[model samples]
Target: MKLQSTPPIPASDRQSPPAVLTLGPASCDAAILAQLLPVAERFRLNSAHLDPGGLVGWLDRLEALFEAEGRSVPVVVDLQGAKMRIGRFPSIPRLPGRVELVPGDRSERADTIPVPHPGLFRHAAPGDRLFLNDARVELEIERVGDERIGARTVRNGPLEASKGINRAPHPLPFEALSDRDASMIDASIGRPFVEYALSFVRSAQDAGLLRPRLGGHRLIAKLERTEAIAHVREIDAAFDESWLCRGDLGAQAGVGELGPIQRRIATLIPSLRNPCYLAGQVLEHMTHFPEPTRSEVVHLYEVARSGFAGVVLSDETAIGRHVAEVAGFLARAAPEE
Candidate 1:
């Protein structure tokens, strides 16, 4: 199915706005809740790095926090689906030079490395590309051997392990949930007030697997990969809601291409009638500094003007020290009559 345009934000509802914020387990503390929940429309708990036990507690705190304020906020639990990524090293030095990917290197200190994901080796071939650290750097598969795959930097940057890795040119043949993600999903079952965000949905098949796991709750497919873009219509047909994850998207398609992709996704996902959010780096400064950048503010307005349903503040709210300030900024910056 072709994508459709988002309905205009109702003039009446424009007077009040909805902005979504993602909170990490650490950020779910009562202090942060006291300042954030009243203004946020939704809270996304990212399950990528969080342990199962920690996530449960985060959910509990989220409920109590909202209740204390005499309001109920929607909770989105983002499952770390079948996306391929490198595990973290003890301390990844900020290498000034490019780190090559070599086969059979098990030691932690090797300049070239072997990722723990055996599936990556099985699927990646020469000429394919891999995205690292939100696409800040690119690694090209130079060779595919019996035991491993070799890659070289196409774009130069310092990379640490545990930064996300994605294959390019073709989608990998595998389930969306890694073993760790499966564990997280199992732990999250039967949780109240939690919606599931399925990441890297490339086709209807991906959505099909996710639907059964969702246990009758809402599932929002996060469309980020090029394959997902190509098969968006099918994925949209399979799921009720979608989020255009523009951060990893910019990495896959370059920053310049993001706008058109966003427009296209907004058009295709009929259920996503709100502003297909232009997420990632919207308030990156707030992650370290207490204030948002002027450019970030402009981008936020751009997203609002485009009529996005909501914007997600990931690292800005999750790990950042300025969670409350970022939440407040989005609440105030949102379009209000």
Candidate 2:
């Protein structure tokens, strides 16, 4: 009945390269890596979560511990590039009527929530589903205009402010790098494994822009956008590895495309032999639940079976309650060695 435990990983499997399990930035315990040094494949730090000083401290500690323990994992910093987010809105625990999803600024009216970016409206149309923050709060776009977007909640739940907004894949165009991303990359220079992972990469050109910022460190092209997948080979060539950030992909990809897309990318990475990892909503419910759902287990197994180098956990470890347990599942859950 234990959801966390799968069949034991065969001895041969344990000897193989451990699946690269990535923990998110919210996992500031810093020492968690040392504790699970053998389990983790990489640690992901977000720019918004820590300043330059804090990052250096954690990196130093983990690297030093690895040296002493003869164990180490790469630390990947997400530039948050091309991650479109909505502006601040009140915690609408329940539904609000006729909310004006405004653009360019926050709204004074309680009924309004601005999405500073104008591009969201450009590609989105009436009836397109919008997922805010998480899948909990879904909106069906009823109106898209020059000034505001109006959507009625499809799945009523609490809505948080300043979280990412994901719409159906509809040519949602934008630059890959922000000025802030450049600054973080500049600040992260010289740190071990301060390697840059560009999110929502659309094309090889987008991935190419990050090389200068990477300072010759590894470049991980995260394929989430539908556009990016279209140019998968070019982007794959432009970077050292590929990343399947499925949570965003689910939100951005058409519902039907999700399955085929996952299969294609999962199939594509192994052939490239570029140390790819699968992430997003992998263990979403395991944060509080004692065991993961049936679907979650199958998904993790699929990741392991894909013959990729690793799989990643975002919220599962970042803000989730059961970080270690989930990592234990991935670290230990392998097929035959």
Candidate 3:
């Protein structure tokens, strides 16, 4: 596919768009983070993957690292709330022919699987569908018992075990922020220049629930689900900023549908005069190679022409081998403002 041509970058404004870089378990080393910071204008620490204690330690280390550099950077904490995920595995398991997800069963297996999150059973019901591994696999809940759920795979694929799960149909009647997320929000209340990204936001009410608890920090909503897309007008009316989570949205609606949705959102969310970030796989190939693929370069160019506020790096910078090089590539390729 031909990428939309990117506008020329002016000589005066050579810097890239405001990019947000994720720093997590994979890229938590001090030296690596220090090297990445100069290229990254913002740092995002995922609270979903880290426990409260781990989150605290990460915040402390990042703060110390920034202090040593004599630079203050924007820090964003992403909360993993009611989003469903597969139980942890010792490693990323190879795809199985078929996997059955039964609640409370924690044993690793080829056909039958366990869901460790007790909350899934508590919140989800029979007839509701579960999206796993970025929605590559689909399962329909046939029955729900006290602690176990009986689900059959409707759609199956080669899943890299332990990836996050999303619910299909509509929003579940659960809190947007988990107890652990609330604590992180509480602790980060007074910190200067910190931003909170609420993931899987389905409605304006979800954003409203966060306002009281979050003491002066900026709130950025991550619109990653079908429900959020349906309610984009309401959500846009509520939150000042939002992220177009192409990866998650692609899971809900096929990747082919992402472009129009992104463009519609950019037009709808005016408060977010800031560019909406095109996330997930922006430079996925760079995880293995030192250089980005031509297709990835075209994708980046398309993102630039789309006029987003910024492009975010996930595995590309957080765990990839060529973190700085990828950042430099993006900086060089971004359309000049």
Every candidate's CA RMSD: 6.8, 5.0, 4.6
lDDT per residue, candidate 3, 203-270, as tens digits?
88887788888776788878887778877767766776778887777877777888888878766645
Best prediction by lDDT: 3
Candidate with maximal TM-score:
3
Q: Model 1 lDDT vs. the true structure?
A: 0.70
Q: Quote each prediction's TM-score.
A: 0.83, 0.80, 0.84
Give the Å shift of residue 68 in candidate 1: 3.0
Better of 1 and 3 by TM-score: 3
Clash list (residue pairs), candidate 3? 275-308, 275-309, 276-309
Give every collision pair in model 1: 3-267, 3-268, 4-267, 81-176, 82-176, 82-177, 274-309, 275-307, 275-308, 275-309
lDDT of 2 by residue, 1-337 (tens): 8678688756654432344444545455645655566666677776644556666676677678778887666778877677766666676676675566877645555667777666676777888878766455678889888777888877767776666777764535556566667667767787766677877777888766677667688888888888888887777778888887777777677556778987887677756746777777767897786578888777665666676666666777777777777656655553343
Worst 10 residues of 3 by lDDT: 89-98
Query: Which ranges of candidate 2 are over 4 A from the true structure?
Result: 1-9, 13-26, 48-70, 103-110, 121-129, 140-147, 293-298, 330-337
lDDT of each: 0.70, 0.69, 0.72
Residue-by-residue lDDT tens digits, candidate 1, 72-160: 87788887666655665434534324455544324476455556666776777788988877877777777888765666777765566
Q: Between candidates 2 and 3, name the one with more favorable TM-score.
A: 3
Q: What is the number of backbone collisions in each predicted candidate, taken in the order shown?
A: 10, 3, 3
Predicted candidate 3, C-alpha RMSD: 4.6
